[model samples]
Target: MQSRPSPVPFPAASAFPKALSWVLVACLGAGLGIVALRPGQAIPAEDTPMEAVAVVPATVTALGALEPEGETLGIAVPSSAQGSRVEQLKVAQGDSVEAGQVLAVLDSYEVRRAAAVRAEQDLRVAEAQLAQVEAGAKNGAIIAQQAEIQRLNADQQARIASQEALVNRLVAEENNAAVELGRYSKLYDEGAISALERDSRQLTLEAAQQNRQQAAAELVRLQSTESPQLLAAQATLAQIAEVRPVDVALAQATVDRAQAGLQQALVDLNQTVVRSPRSGVVLDILAQAGERVDAGGNLLELGQLTQMAVRTEVYESDLQRVAVGQPVQVSSAALPQVLQGQVVRLGWKVQPQSIITTDPSATIDARVVEVQVALDEPSSAIAQRFTNLQVTVEIDTQ
Candidate 1:
């Protein structure tokens, strides 16, 4: 009876629980198998909404390419010959110039005027000196001196002739007295004359002897004095004739001094007119007309821009790769144009760190070397277009 009661209670338990569980399990396994066996398929936009995101492709390059090592240098306009205020400006900015061309001129009015004055003064002084030398003397003084010399000569000759005549007269008187005395002496000797007559004849002979001796002395004196005076007068005339040579030398010296002064004045005048020392284009004009300028003052700036050069700094790591004569490519951030250039030189030393970047991680304390690159083919047109333009230079490491 008990066993029958227990079977009756279990019968009311689950309603086909085992059979229903098996069916559900089979259905789930088949559904999972169909899902796994089907080919992979993308979910449709309509079925599952997807996010609309714009994706950009990433560039594959080295970190060095992203931030290449380069240098930025200041633009320099070449200098011209330092001068004073510009009196004349021949060319303007952006003008093509040749070698030895005159670009500007300083004030030359004063210089030219001074030069003219000096030239005129030189000529006038030279002419005056020449005329003075040619004139010989003022107020006919030389002519009067010649006349006086002639008169002195005539007087000396007349005196000499008078003295000679006196000597001849004295000699004649002495001869007559001598003959009378001789006759008286012979009468006395022959005993035909008295003692008184003999004494008187001896006295006359003694007196004639004395007179002859005096005349001879007078003649000697006249000859000596007259000849010397005549010779002296002739010597004086000869000296006068040679005086013109000395006068000519003095005049020539004066002319030379005048010429030297004129030359110095001309040099000073030329300094006032400042001319260009070389041929180049004017880059800057610091002075103008009517502006006072001192010597060596900066007046203008000139430069040769036909050929350009770039100065860049390379990192210490990449410095070994750079060398002289290596080819380089130059580009400008603003222009974005490429230029061909070659390395002309390399720095021997290194430079200090720069403070351009604030990132501590980006900054390096390592030294940098400078490199100079010259354009292979430079043109005036290109230079003018890109004058003072900032450029970036790149050197191949491989």
Candidate 2:
């Protein structure tokens, strides 16, 4: 039996046995490869297809920021409302507003309103005065100088008459005193009256004479100076109408002054209520109701977001390849889709790159030219959602 086993070992050493061993080795490798690749599993990188046709030609890439086509319009509190506390705020951030729409109210409105009312009252008073003067001029041509003159003459005559009466009384008193003095002197010579009584009568006669002289002088003054003054006043009255041109002008001036004051008060009152200067969306709220702010201080920010553009900075070296009206592709990590646009403007000068990336490995310093790309309609719809957001722009310079 051992001899027969030796004879079978001869087949194991044959060429067919060697071929079978090679086949086994090949089958094992095939099985191992099959095991490595299950259904729905990814193929090895080496097995992936790398062949592709020429698609995108050449492009100039740049970094940029998104913005409205007209750029942001910065809005602040009205200069007239500076240094006032906000009493009422009608809108908040992100609220859309129209031109001249009230955004907030200042606490000084009550004061401004009071001033306006006073100015209006003053204006009315001036207007009424002017109207009264005009009416007088129309109704009465000129003041009656004759009537004024007659009144003055009458007053002068009355004064003159009173002086005459006083002179007559003093003359009669003087005559009486003289008679008494003579009687007293004669009695003294006869030694019938005392020396004291004779001296008293002499003093009484002197006093009566002095009084008559003063009364006569006063009557003369009234007839001369008083009559002339009355005549002069009558002459002046005759020269002017009921209301002179100068008077009218003064009244008109008062009206003008009142008008200016009223206008100023109205302006101040309008300023008390802050209004939006443009139609747009509110971007940020810098102040709230009941907050006090200084003149010209910022209270909020607004912008037009529906229509937007991309402000890009291209390499100076690539300036020649890029031009206005060139088509562009804009992309951003903040968004999911690639947006389209066209270059609307080219920078006239070259400057340092302003689009610095947050990545530490990014190149921050480079000479670049600023470019403005206007977004297309479909792209604008997407751009409106990301104002001031940084983006990558690719201009097809091919």
Candidate 3:
């Protein structure tokens, strides 16, 4: 009751402080809003204290797949061994192999091996013949050859003398026949001789001329050269006296030819066996024993699993954001945790995206550039088993 009586109109001055507090609160909110909305705006020093803003690193993301350092390799038969079937597989899938290690043998192995053996035998025979030639003729052979040469020379002289005597006798007979023919012709022209007698004289003259010509040719042949037997005996004697360079050269040439043949045969034999070109693991075997290699002749698929990498296909538009040596993060449902890597290369060509996403809204026809990211050691060990596994990649652009 006393308070009601004393209740006077609230003073404007008393309400001034409360109204001032409400106005101050509103001004504070407006200042904070201005600072947040326009960060570049200058604030009065006497107003609110400034706070630091956090910054986040930017990133680019794309679909990717895990692979060996240099990607998978389809090991094929040597081109020289085309059309050959596999006779044996020395290594199976999952086996590790070193460069030049035998992985398979072709059907031509045994045949080629036999050919090589024959070539080797030929080489040995050639070498023996070369040694025999280089050693020169033995003393007993030299004596026999000299005696044969003397005998042939004596026989040639006697034959030449005999042929000369025969030539002289035939020449005399030819002259006599010519004189008789002249006489017969004169008699025939005078009609003093019978036609049969004239014909008989002509035949006698022709036979005499033929005999004379044969004798002359035989004499010339005898005088012109030594007997072939005599020449051969002389050659053998010369070879016995000293090893002729020509003979040695001929034998050496034979040896060289045999060696070349052996080399070629060995090369062909080696071709029958397929060897690895590099150290790697055999991921698959495309050809088995008794199986004919395909058109490509691929024998197996192999790769170096020691180091792993991610091949990411980034959109062409975002390619500018990627660079070599940049850090990367790779993740996949197949992996237990995120993996770390570094960008190592960028593709030179822009190609259509090959990896399709499960999300229907994704850009299926996006043009992309392949970017290679090499994984760290630990990450590589983890990814070794996941070759060709699709993965998500995040590249730090900062």
lDDT tens digits by residue: candidate 2, 334-383: 97799999999998999999888898998888899999999999889888
Count of steric clashes across candidates, in order: 0, 1, 0
Candidate 2 RMSD to the real structure: 13.6
List clashing residue pairs in candidate 1.
Answer: none
Off by over 4 Å in 2: 1-57, 137-241
Q: Residues 1-398, candidate 3, lDDT per residue (tens digit)?
A: 45545566777777899989999999999988786865677755786788889975499999999999898999888788888989999998889999999999999999999999999999999999888888887778888888898899999999999999998998898888888888988999899998788888888888998998998898899999889999988877885779778888999999999999999999999989999999999988988899888567688999999999998999998999889999999999989889999999999999999988899989999899999999999999899889899999999999
In candidate 1, how many Å is residue 198 off?
A: 13
Ranking by lDDT: 3, 2, 1
| lDDT value for model 3 | 0.91
Q: Candidate 2 at 266: error in angstroms?
A: 2.5
Give the worst 10-residue stretch by lDDT in candidate 3.
1-10
1-398: candidate 1 lDDT, tens digit per residue: 45544443455447788878999999999889778765775545676777789963221111111111132122111222223445676666655556556555556646666676977688687869777767655546667667767887788778778878877887787788789888888898899999899888778777877877887787778667756666676666665555487788878887887877777776655554544554445555656665645544555555555556666667776776777877777675544456766777888988864423345676566566767777755422344445455565676544
Where model 1 places Cα greater than 4 Å from the true spot, the runs are: 1-86, 89-91, 94-159, 176-215, 225-270, 294-297, 333-336, 352-368, 378-381
Give Cα-based local distance difference scores for all models.
0.62, 0.86, 0.91
Q: Write the number of the candidate with greater lDDT, choosing between 1 and 3.
A: 3
Could you report the Cα RMSD, in angstroms, for every candidate shown?
12.9, 13.6, 13.8
